[model samples]
Target: MRNRHIATALLAASLLLFAAGCKKKTPVAPPPPPPPPPPTVVEKAPAAVISSFTAEPSTIVRGEASTLRWSVANATEVTIDNGIGAVSASGSRQVYPTSNTTYRMTAKGGGGDAVAAVTVAVTTPPPPPPPPPAAKASLEERMSREIQDIFFDYDKSEVREDSRATLQRNADALKTILSEFPSAVVSIEGHCDERGSAEYNLGLGDRRSASVREFLIQVGVPGDRLKPISYGKEKPVCTEESESCWQRNRRAHFVGVQ
Candidate 1:
């Protein structure tokens, strides 16, 4: 009986050890898949760029104008200095600057900024030339300047001794003027004081003018170029009743006629 009991206890112990050895173990998670490989890293692009900036005519006069031109790339906004506000990426503008000037361009984008500069040279125009010289004097103006009148004594129809020297000088001047202006004619007008009647003064004035003409002809003046006329008392130089005033009215006046 004691041996059988011992055998049964040994069998139970063996069965228990076999059941424990057949059980399965749990698995690890695998390190969470290395946190998804940290994702793919990327870098962004750079700033905007300025392609070109220039002035069409760099030099100009005071009242002249010039053209400003530019080109930009990769820019979100663009602008220019000197009253030129916002502008397109590429464009041109007309400008009139009174003096020398410098223009600057700026371009901005998500990345950074870009800048460019251009200069416009200015020069003043020269003054206009002096006005043309004055023209020469005409023939009629020369005649008025060179010729003069000769005076005579009161109530005189004949050439007086005092008037002979003046008459001779006038004859010499007439010769020179007539040589240059052959077509011009001279009128010797005889005027008298207001002393006598109109018809009587007219006859006296005629005698006076004819005597002057005869004297001019004797000094070598042509008869056809000389015309003698009488004004009588109708054309007195002075109206005052005086000898000196009357003397002024008695004279032979010379005039040029074309």
Candidate 2:
């Protein structure tokens, strides 16, 4: 008892200072909820817009045809090239290119691709105009363009009553050139005028070509298509002793044989 050990060591230091001031502070775990704020990102949508590509007759002429209009926006797929594949975004197509061409268009979605181009022009065609100039191929060139020649009177030829209307218009133009050359043969030559006597002017030019082959066989021509001849006084178409040069060497001459 040293004074009861100083009051029991001051009551064990006053119960260790009231158990270190009631000892109960060990709960501080609420600072781990600040690591969950990094998850929220999503963006994508923009690219695909051509809104118009055209060629409605941009020019064409080789069997002609052209038409390829188009329009697009934020597409999901659209295409066009030479062979014009998959397409439908507001369209029209009818091409027939055979020479010059250039056409491209592509539009795709999901924010990706887009492009447009248009060009179509081609031409060439002209030639036709040259055929018209041919006609006059003989029958003695159509009887010298339709026969005509008759004269006589100075040493007389029986048919000279003004040569009976020029021997009935030379027997209607030799019956229209013997009805178109029916094996043609017409010689009635009888000319004379150097004042006769080349053997009595060949019997007065064989009675002036047998009186124009008996007036063209009484007007129906065809004493077997006539053939009387006699170049009496030797073909004197006017040796000019005059009587209008012996009436132009008395005549009744027509000749076309083949």
Candidate 3:
């Protein structure tokens, strides 16, 4: 009986040891999958973009037309400044600018707004300066203004020493007239002082006019361009009897005809 009791106790202890060794371990549940990586946050960018804004002819002259082309991406609204109102997202328009101009486009959407610009250069040349006024054409009048009357000493048919420059100027004026108008004609009138008698003064005037004509011929003037006539003392510029007045009355006057 005591052996039987000892065997039973050993069997009971063995069974308890076996039960403790075979028991299943409880799972740690994989640490809750690392908390699902903190629910990753995401950010979104704007949805609108200006694809293109361009001018077909960037430079244009006044009164000319240019085309403005534009395109947008993901835009709900589009507009252009400078009189261009709402327009399609992608389209073109003809623009006529009298002066330099700048065109801007605005694209709007839920995400953001985009802006773009294009310039259409306008070049307007200034009006040509007024044509220069036509040149004047009065050669004889010019010559008359340039040459002075040839004066003579009282009752003398010979040219005075001081009168040589005057004669040369007259010759130059006559040459210019003839060069410009080949068919031009001229007349030289001679007068004498009041101290001489009418007939005597007439002869003196004739001699004085002949002397002038001869001098002009020697200075390269055509003979046909010269004609001499005597007015004598009848047409005196100064009627007084003083020496100064008489000297003024004796002169050779030139007249040009075309």
Instruction: Give the winner by lDDT.
Output: 3
Question: Tens digit of lDDT per residue, candidate 1, span 167-245?
Answer: 8888888887777677988888888888878898888888888899999999898989989998888887789999888
Q: Could you tell me the TM-score of candidate 1?
A: 0.47
Candidate 3, position 12, lDDT: 100
RMSD of each: 16.5, 20.1, 18.2
lDDT string for model 3 (1-258, tens) is: 999999999999999999997796676655555545665544544578998999979999898899999889888899999998999999999999888899999999768899999999999967988876675567567656876788988768888889998898888878887787787778788999888899998999998889999999999988888889999988988788788898788999887777
Error of 3 at 3 (Å): 99
Model 2: lDDT equals 0.80
Q: Write down the worst ten-residue block by lDDT for model 3.
A: 37-46
Model 1 regions lying over 4 Å from their true place: 1-148
Ranking by TM-score: 3, 1, 2
Per-candidate TM-scores read 0.47, 0.26, 0.49
lDDT of 3: 0.86
Q: Is candidate 1 or candidate 2 better by TM-score?
A: 1
